[model samples]
Target: MSSSDIFIGETIGTAILILLGGGVCAAVTLKASKARGAGWLAIALGWGFAVMTAVYISAPLSGAHLNPAVTVGLAIKDGDWSNVPVYFAGEFLGAMIGAALVWVAYYGQFRAHLTDEDVVGDLSARAADTKAVEAREKGAGPVLGVFSTGPEIRNPAQNLATEIVGTFVLIIAVLTQGLNDAGNGLGVLGGLITALVVVSIGLSLGGPTGYAINPARDLGPRIVHALLPLPNKGGSDWTYAWVPVVGPLIGGALAAGVYNLAFA
Candidate 1:
């Protein structure tokens, strides 16, 4: 496929991923219904499906680096600079469009079921009063956001440690199995490895805060959450937003640092 075709495929594939991934989050959270949260498994499985599908679709053409982190890691490891800019821009824009489509797909139901009060209640930030008023005009609420924070994390140090540990595991996995040495990987075997990691974290370490290991995955959706006006929207919860970004970034870097020290 041509570069143009690859770009188009990247955009479409990314959109479908977010549409399904974030859509499931909203299906239950935004509007109350019998099927609320029915899609938790769907959300998780859909993300894996999205990654696999996006790669399958774009691999022959452009290698399908659909994630910024993956792209960054690849550049760091292999020094492939030719298509970096194009792939980076494509992945970012694709995420935006993907999220926007999720916003559009669920627009009507938002208006029908949501009310002003519900939007007000969902704000993650304390400066919710002003934000809620703003969201009303835009027809949005708290946002298409996901965050991870340690429960009972009143002390800053322990919380930081938890984030570091989780991210360390994730980055190490990404490096060893994903971008570092693609040859010896478990191949299809790696898929279940990650699924197990997520489940284990959710069951054990995830109690305090959900695992917001990917910065783009959390903040990108949160930005959309703020902009896409829906009923009963809440605050952006800017306070805790950094946990995912900082934690994962640090974790990834630490994992890389450790890997280099041991193996390099």
Candidate 2:
């Protein structure tokens, strides 16, 4: 495919990916949504389905490398860096657009969720099982998890390691199983296989840092989180932001190295 096709395809595919993926997070996190309190299995499966859908839509145009980690892994494997910037541009832009669309889709829920002073500020008033409410600046922010990942435990080294390992598995799967005959994009069944792989990683490794195996997936939505004007929305947690991006890139590079040595 041409560069224009690659850019447009990635932008649209990634937008669709984040729209549904983040939409699930919003559905589970927002107060007025019916899916609120749906557990992690819902999230993992939702994201896997999102990947499947997006890849099927964009695989012909840009190989549907919606995640930067996947794109980087492919680039490294092929020893080609010329189109990396274009891929990054489309992926990040699509992620932000998708996050914004999620906000639009759940605007009422967000207003209700964020404006609840008792929910935002009063831990005593919250339900015993309320996992979505988090206090910051003495009030709650829109749940960051809907837009980006955060660690269950705030250990930086461990958090980084978790992202690295999760992304390594993801990149390895893309390299080994999710390639077309031309080896540029996913095969006809690659999307489904990759989606299942994503589900597996999320089920097994998502606990630590929410399995942010993609840099653009985390950073773009983080940028959206910082920019959006939601009342009582807490800080964007920028201190931990680099872990998702850096760890996945490192993991992608590592996966590519392993593929070259063992599989290529």
Candidate 3:
């Protein structure tokens, strides 16, 4: 195929990825009056499904990288430096575009709920659990917003720990496949590892701040959250935001570290 096709495929794949990936997040988080506090398990599974599906569809085309972190990781590991720029550009553009689309798709959900600046859904939803569910059934009604972090714990130390650990698991799995023989089943097998990693993180680690293991995953959607309409939304909680970013970066570095140590 032509270089143009590869670039375009990468862009389209990443866009749909964030939409379905980040989109599920907004669906569960936003007070859509349909399903509230659906829990981080739902979000993580949605993410896992999104990753595999994008891989299935785009793997043969542009490799369905979906995240810049992954592209850089691959480039670092495999030495396919020529394609890195193309994939990175595609992934970045797609994330921005996906953020915009997500805001649009969940527009109704954002608009229907009360916007209390002090409303932190995690605490308020539990207190209003009964009301949250009642509103969901009504459709376009009020639903309790159970605010939680991805990687789930609230404490910065704990949050960073989860991010670092979650991402470490993810990068290691991918590199395991990279280390295998060229024609091995690692291509498909890698997806299963990723699925398990995400599921495990959600079921176990997701109780706190919700594991925003992927930077663009959190940042992209958070950007949309800022743009969208919602009542009484709390601060983006920027103070603890760096954990996910840094933890994942550390995790990626750790993986690179491990990979490098092996050769050394």
Candidate 4:
């Protein structure tokens, strides 16, 4: 694929991926939404479907490597780094755009959920009763799971390790799977299979850091969460931001190393 194709395809694919993926979070988390409280299974399936949709749409043009970890793993496997930057540019840009669209689509729900009397009251009383607001913000606005992932327990060591292991599994699967024949994209059925892998990861490994596995998937939307004008939106938690970014890169590189040593 040419640089332009890679950019365009990744941009569009990642946008769709985040749109559907984030939309699921919004749907399940927002109070006013019909699907609110749908639980984690919905999220896992939603993200799986998101990957499938994005991959199918962008595979022809850019191999649909919506996750930066996937791109880096492939580059390491192939020993070509020229297109990595292009893929990164597209994935991040697309993630931001997709997050913005999710906001637009769920504007009413966001406003209702964030501005609810119980929630606003907690925000006002946070200095005195932090736990009171924690209930409201568990999955609601300000610190939404839709846009990005967070750890159940705030252990940096464990969080980083969780992301690395999760991403290694992902990249390793991509490298070994038959869908990766082209070296640039997955085969016709690869999208569906990869989506299943994502769901499995979420079900099995997602509890601890929400299974970011993809740097662009986490960081880009986190950036939007920080910049977007959402009422009562809490801190973007910038301190933990580097964990997802760095962990995924390390996992991708490690996966590539393993692939080179064992399979290549």
TM-scores vs. true structure, each candidate: 0.68, 0.93, 0.73, 0.92
- Each candidate: what lDDT? 0.55, 0.89, 0.61, 0.88
Every candidate's CA RMSD? 5.4, 4.2, 7.4, 2.9
Look at candidate 4 and give me any clashing residue pairs. 142-233
**CA shift of 219, model 4, Å:** 0.7
Of the pair 3 and 4, which is ahead by lDDT?
Answer: 4
RMSD of 2: 4.2
lDDT of 3 by residue, 1-264 (tens): 345666776677767767776677667766654656777677779877877776666656675566655655666666566776777667656665776686677767666545533333454564468665444333222321222133333567877877777777777666666332442112666666766776777677656656666666666555544544555443454555567667776776677577667842
lDDT of 1 by residue, 1-264 (tens): 355765665566555556666666566655553446664454455555655555555554554545554455445544455555666566657767767777677776566555444454443553466754665444323343421122355445666667667767765665576331342112344544544554455455654555555555566666766676654554556656667667666775677677667755
Q: Is candidate 2 or candidate 4 better by lDDT?
A: 2
The per-residue C-alpha lDDT of model 3 at residue 250 equals: 77
Candidates ranked, most accurate by lDDT first: 2, 4, 3, 1
Q: How accurate is candidate 2 locally (lDDT)?
A: 0.89
Residue 154 CA displacement from its true place in model 4, Å:
0.4
Best of the two (3, 4) by TM-score = 4
Better of 1 and 3 by lDDT: 3
What pairs collide in candidate 2? Answer: 141-233, 141-234
- Write the number of the candidate with greater TM-score, choosing between 2 and 3: 2
Candidate 3: segments with Cα more than 4 A from true spot: 1-6, 80-82, 115-154, 178-186, 229-234
